[model samples]
Target: MNFALGFKTTMGESGSMEALEKQLICPICLEMFTKPVVILPCQHNLCRKCASDVFQASNPLWQTRGSTTVSTGGRFRCPSCRHEVVLDRHGVFGLQRNLLVENIIDIYKQESKRPLQPKAEQQQLMCEEHEEEKINIYCLTCETPTCSMCKVFGAHKNCEVAPLQTIYNRQKTELGDGIAILVAGNDRVQAVISQMEDVCRTIEVRITEVHLPKAQL
Candidate 1:
């Protein structure tokens, strides 16, 4: 799927919104990420559940159906970059959640939920090739937005096409799930920031106390 989000002004072609959307999809499930999305050591993100599955599959004991279970500290390769990832005692739970990705997902969901005005829809519905035609079809093969004329006579004439509405609905659902994941990530980041701020405050106070004694002397 062209996971790109497009922006059209009733008369303009969609921008790179579709491209941005694609980045949020999990390679393992081929869907938008779920809650507790983990950033692997290689910097690739995966849904926590998907990471757990990969970790289990990599274990010889798990594959043989042996009664012995490996500790969460086992290692697994990243599904995307194939980088080796060593988990902590909590396994995938020990991996850092990507707050930035989660925040973008939340913003996208909010924007998606907003009803587009008739004027805005008209501005965003036009095709780049057929300026007069609204984008009514999605080219499944090429993963591009197309006007009816494009389907009949343009480059996508021989390609598989689906109604734009269907794709739109599906993308909306994916965005909704993304929002949930982002919320959890945001909380995790906030906690860390808070802890770091407290540590900094303590160090500042200690430094001030040490300096005060020297100045008094």
Candidate 2:
């Protein structure tokens, strides 16, 4: 089935707000629509910045600074509907309530066809373009963490070597869920340690009080 039909079918299960959003998205940006600017005359809508960029690319003369005239700006047409829409009279707004509806519909479809984690893990591992030094060890090819000697003499030759820290940061961003899980675990550990410290302090105080009373008696 087409995306529109599937979108509608999934949206039927969602609330009213979702149904309105499915039509509001800019075809370029797959995410929620932003700065929705409607084309004049045709009444079709596109993201403001996206539409301008499209127009500029379509007409090379539009890019030259101070070279454009009033007529030059009006000559550009909408790429999608091929309709004439002038930028001067049009206004931009951040009306994203309709965009949210489409997101909800898409999210529902993705949830319904959830991928099996175990099955995904069973798939073959893809090879990285960077030269392989060892089983999993990477050959940086002297571009980053790897040294010049390693690039020339070692298994790592001229290859696209990225910094280890950069790789680590990207992985962290991608595995945000894993980071949340780790944070929760660390919090639990801290709570347990705090409780144990309190218990130890109470035990020491009780011992001191009991011993002094017994010695005096």
Candidate 3:
């Protein structure tokens, strides 16, 4: 049986969104897998960013200026099973994307947006790939929130994604700390500016004193 078919069969029997969502989580981040999820030789999935971070940790000398673009090939162990994943010169970018998981994430997000209702109000959603069959499992979106603005138009049209979990929180926290550092530096700059203004004032006073009229020729 095909991998997707087998999974779908299991999903049908389990009929639990919570259980399905649990599998979508990345082991390293412990959050839902973000875009461009990669599959290791061990068959475990990871977000590309997480994979790059792990790869860099394993090969710090190859890390560039905060980007995953690597100059040489290296290897990193899968966080799930510790299976070594060898990379080419392209680094994590060279890894094959798990498109099946990406598609599943899209479906998961769509299901998350719809409100739960009685069977009478419930509408069946058919998968684009498997149009003949209604989407497996019942909708249990009451616990999840939906955003109307996400699908409207403009820049947010393609803005659909699982709520920022692992990467976003970490980046935001790092950003908050960075803001504090910038604020402290700005305080030093303001003090320097005040001192410069004081020097100008003293220079003006010295010039006035030198210009004072004297009895001597």
Query: Using Cα atoms with residue i matched to residue i, what is each candidate's TM-score against the true structure?
Result: 0.45, 0.29, 0.46
Candidate with the larger lDDT of 1 and 2: 1
Model 1 global lDDT (CA atoms, 0 to 1): 0.78
Candidate 2 structure lDDT: 0.54
Question: Over the stretch 1-217, how does candidate 3's per-residue lDDT look in tens digits?
Answer: 7764554445542246678889899888899999999998899999999998999899887755566554678998888888888888778888999998998888776665655434544565554434454433221233222333322432234444344244457669999999999999999999999999999999998888788888531
Q: How close is candidate 3 to the true structure, as a TM-score?
A: 0.46
Q: In model 2, which regions exceed 4 Å deviation? A: 1-15, 64-71, 86-217
Q: lDDT score, residue 166, model 2? A: 71
Candidate 3: 10-residue stretch with minimal lDDT? 137-146
Q: Per-residue CA lDDT of candidate 2, range 68-115, in tens?
A: 352334245655577765543222222222343445446555644544
What's the C-alpha lDDT at position 39 in model 2? 43
Q: What is the C-alpha RMSD of each candidate to the true structure, in Å?
A: 20.0, 21.9, 20.9
Q: After superposition, how far is residue 209 of candidate 1 from its true place, in Å?
A: 81
Clashing pairs in 2: 18-101, 21-98
Better of 2 and 3 by lDDT: 3
lDDT, residue 35, candidate 2:
43
